[model samples]
Target: MADKKPEPATKNPKKANLLDHHSIKHILDETVSEIVSSRGYVEDVRLSNVRLLLGTVIIVIALFAQFYKKKFPENRDFLISCIVLYIVFNGLLQLIIYTKEKNAILFTYPPAGSFTSTGLEVSSKLPRFSDIYTLTIASADPKSISANPPVELTKSVTKWFTKDGVLVEGIFWKDVEALVDEYSKEPKKRK
Candidate 1:
């Protein structure tokens, strides 16, 4: 018999792309943007960028104030003002974000089998300030959408990036690919 060599295992392209921390964030951002836009919401990148910059600056100032407090005890009022400003700024931003059309019902999916549906609700006018994203998926019996009965479903999770943009230790690239694949599937036509 002739000697034969074994074939090397090939990595999935999607999974391979998701392996990097930066790419994972990028893909998730793109996917979420698509998902949100498909439901009729526009992504305000200018607002998003403004929120991110302001939030970052506030945090940096707070940290600097904290460090300064230890070195110069006489300047306690500066640290206090920075902390107060940070809190007040956040409260005002939240008030602005929730000012118009909050918790808008985006889409209602047709029943999977026969009796239930999964609806999506979104904070339609909120400016996204952080890296963390929240998607609300509600499942209820289709006939009783008025009653709004809740159905138990599996918890959704994602590989989170650190404050410094590094991926955390628990989630892997394959896991991310699996999540994206499952959610990206086409829906069945209703009869």
Candidate 2:
């Protein structure tokens, strides 16, 4: 009788390669979504800054009108009207600022020389995030950049954070990586 050998056992029986392909595709999709979402946060910071500045201007104008009315009591009604209009406009601006501040992400402007928040002085232009942290730490106080840093570096860092992850303040790249790993391990736990 001829010796018979058993057929080799298949390493995977459930079309694991296909499953793996699906898994890889899913991971890629999720990663891209997360990156896009985080970028929106950065954009929010820019918008918030603009809102804050405009709100401040409106408030200042309102205060000035109120003071003017108080000083010139001769034209009481006219002065009062100006004050009232300014107050209403200022109130609207404040409302917008409040909404943006609550919903928007915080961004650090880089250090140029030194600045005081209570004073709200921008020396020249805005700083990039990486340089901002470093310069702010080095400076006696936070300040604006003399000129806007090259956009290339800022864009690169933004892209890097989205793809590889970034260590922002206490938010570390390793921490993000661990979170992603945990989420991937148990998709149900995410919800």
Candidate 3:
């Protein structure tokens, strides 16, 4: 029998485009403009910048007042009150501005699933593989897996195989548990 050459492994081998480049400056400019022009509450860069600057200045002044309070101990309460007032005012202003912007944005993009004041709908799609892998890797207990091969190998393989796999409902539950565990270690925030 005549020897025949083996067929090429892949019919269309995907080519890596290492030369693909995008202008960072252009992207940055576009992003900046988009954020600045955004109709959401926190979108107005000019207003936000001004408020932030004023708030910072007020905070510095308040600190200085506290430092000098030893000389005028009688006015300590007044200085403290002023500081509190400035902080409250700044926070309230920011909240109002952000709320307005958020309302505007939400109004522009109405919720597709349900009617809402913000007009935003919660997406029903499952989380991506990267998110799942991250949560899994972060939650992997050292005692659970044998310390033979590195955990990274297992994580990488899991991520690779599950990249396009259908995410079962249990996966979401696992992710939620992982998230809760992760956040439990952090400082509690006021609702």
Cα RMSD for candidates in order: 14.5, 20.7, 19.5
Query: How far in Å is the alpha carbon of 64 misplaced in model 2?
Result: 3.6
lDDT of 3 at 66: 66
Report how far off residue 164 is in candidate 1 (Å).
Answer: 33
Predict model 2's lDDT versus the native.
0.34
Encode model 3's per-residue lDDT on 51-168: one tens digit a residue.
6776787777677776763566687777777778777767776786665433121112321342222221111111233222221112112242221111111122132222333222
Local lDDT at 32 for model 1: 44
Q: By lDDT, who's the top model here? A: 1
The digit string of per-residue lDDT tens for model 2 on 58-154 reads: 7776666666634565767766776777777777767765653332223333322423221111111123322111101011122433322211111
Please, what is the whole-model Cα lDDT of each candidate in the order they appear?
Answer: 0.43, 0.34, 0.34
lDDT of 2 at 123: 14
lDDT of 1: 0.43
Worst 10 residues of 2 by lDDT: 131-140
Highest-scoring model, TM-score: 1
TM-score against truth, every candidate: 0.33, 0.30, 0.28
Stretches of candidate 2 exceeding 4 Å from the true structure: 1-46, 66-70, 98-100, 107-173, 177-191
TM-score of model 2 vs. true structure: 0.30
